[model samples]
Target: MTAAGMRARGNVRTLVLAGALVTVTAALGMVGCTLFQSEQVSKGQKLYAHYCMHCHGEHGQQNEGYNWGQMPDPRPKDLSNKGEMSTFKDEEIFGTISRDMKDTTPEVGDKIGDDEFAVPTMPTFKYTLSEEEIWSIVAYVRTLHGMKLTYNVEARKKELQDQLQTAQQKADQAKQALEAADKKAEDEAEKKGVEVDEAATAKEQEANVAAIKELEAGKTAFANFTARPKLAAVPRPDLTMAETEAAKLAETGKRLYGNKYGCNACHRVGEAGGLVGPALDRAGFRLNGTWVYRWIKYPQSMKPETRMPNLGISDQDAKAITMYLATLRAPKPEKPIEKAAH
Candidate 1:
């Protein structure tokens, strides 16, 4: 071949090589993105199972094996329903998950029986989970409705910073209000030529100081917050057991019921716990193990308006708690001596 022809061929080869490199790089980048998304979804699934599955169900439908018809007016929504879930934006869902949905005060006419207000049963997760964890959960929830995960970390961080600023401003305003109130009280007392109630003033001051401390602590927590991606380990409860295995499981349940889950907060076993719920001292005699297990797993399924929130108890944990509760039976009655003599 001529020298000019050979040069042209070499040029073509160079262009082809550059094209291949670009294609390969693009493919690798796509793969990396897919892997990252998969990891995020996996982390979310673990979190959902641990914290949300009890009420939201395994697939975001309501929990199984209960008469949902008997549930309260606004039962847990069908999260897996695409038509419903699609209407919600990612940020809106994230907000709902992070904040409490209950309405503390309702319109006077809207109030239900006895001073009770009908409100959503969903609880706040902001205290229990970090911002990143909540975003991950949002991503996972989207998957249930066949939606893609779309998260903007930088935008979210900016939003959080703005919120912190607003909170700081509110705290300053509250302090100013408290100070003004104190000064006004002192001036009025002086003008009236009467001494202010020292004890009442001291108590009010102490409460205000405590409130300020709490606000400061909350601000500190917000300022120092950072998102770190990590997968949580999901607990698997043991369910297969024989009658002989009851004692061992019961012991485990005792610890979980009394300490881990803080069941005693609302339930009374003997002389302890609050009066918010019924006493459980004779639960063994009154309740069945299977019934107890289901109740602990998801209480809303049985009684939609029950104050008990699902603690995401695993099957094993529920079983163990059931065994422990079963041990709280009343003592067997004694037979009469006259019947034995006859």
Candidate 2:
């Protein structure tokens, strides 16, 4: 073969090798992205189980007993409903999760001070979770409506930038308004030959200052924004116990009912407890053991209108509580009191 031909063949081989390397790199990058997203979803699942599953259910739908009579928006949102979930954007969901709808700025309207909905049932989580943790929850919630788990870092950055820009604009406009008000007031005072009241726009001045501070904070948040890393998975509670372990389980249940879970706050074990719920001293006689277990584990599932909030009780704890309650058999009434004579 000619020397030039041999050199040409070598060049073709080099190009093929380069293309293969590029393909392999692209594939690895895709795999890494997939793994990261999976981890985020896994973390989100753990969070949802711990914080949301009781109200939202094991799935995003409400628990089995769907009847929540008389309460406004009667039942918790059916998050698994694709059509309903489709109406909300990811950011809107994040905001809803983080803020109390009634008190959050811009979202408030005629409903803000309504007597009927004065206290929102959904609690605000802004104080409890970091921004990344909230975002992770949002990612997991998307899956309920059949969306993929994704964290669009660039998109979120743009949102932060837009928010910062809006805040800055509001701050500027407030400053200008305050300055204009002051100038007008000064001019009027000068024309009238009276002293200007420096405190005339005191409230407006305070509002302007607040707006400026908000703008500065927004800027800082935007500057520091970055993609959240995957969180460590939360451990699941152990629910395993042998059938013969009744005595020990009941002892644990006694501690949980009185101390750990605060069951006594609403229930009465004897003359010593609250009157909000029926006395449980005769729970063993009045209620079935199996029924007690189910009720404790998922209160809403049995009676949607019940005020008892599911405390995310584990199966083991529920069983223990049931056993403990079973031990509370009040001595049989000596004799049923005769009905009062009419």
Per-prediction TM-score: 0.45, 0.44
Tens-place lDDT digits, model 1, residues 1-342: 999999999999999999999999999989987887787789888988766665566777764312232233345688889999898888778877665323233351223455332234455455456677778788898998899767675466676677667666666766776677678778888999988655545645665676677667655555434532122333344455787798888887777665455565446565555334567788888886666777777675666545465565656667888889988975643631121110
In angstroms, the error of model 2 at 276 is 15
Best by lDDT: 2
Give model 1's TM-score versus the native structure.
0.45
For each candidate, the alpha-carbon lDDT, in order, equals: 0.65, 0.66
* Top model number, TM-score: 1
Estimate, for each residue in 24-67, the C-alpha lDDT of model 2 and write its tens digit. 99999899878867787788788777656545656687542222
Off by over 4 Å in 2: 64-72, 103-119, 154-342
Clashes of each: 1, 0
RMSD of 1: 16.4
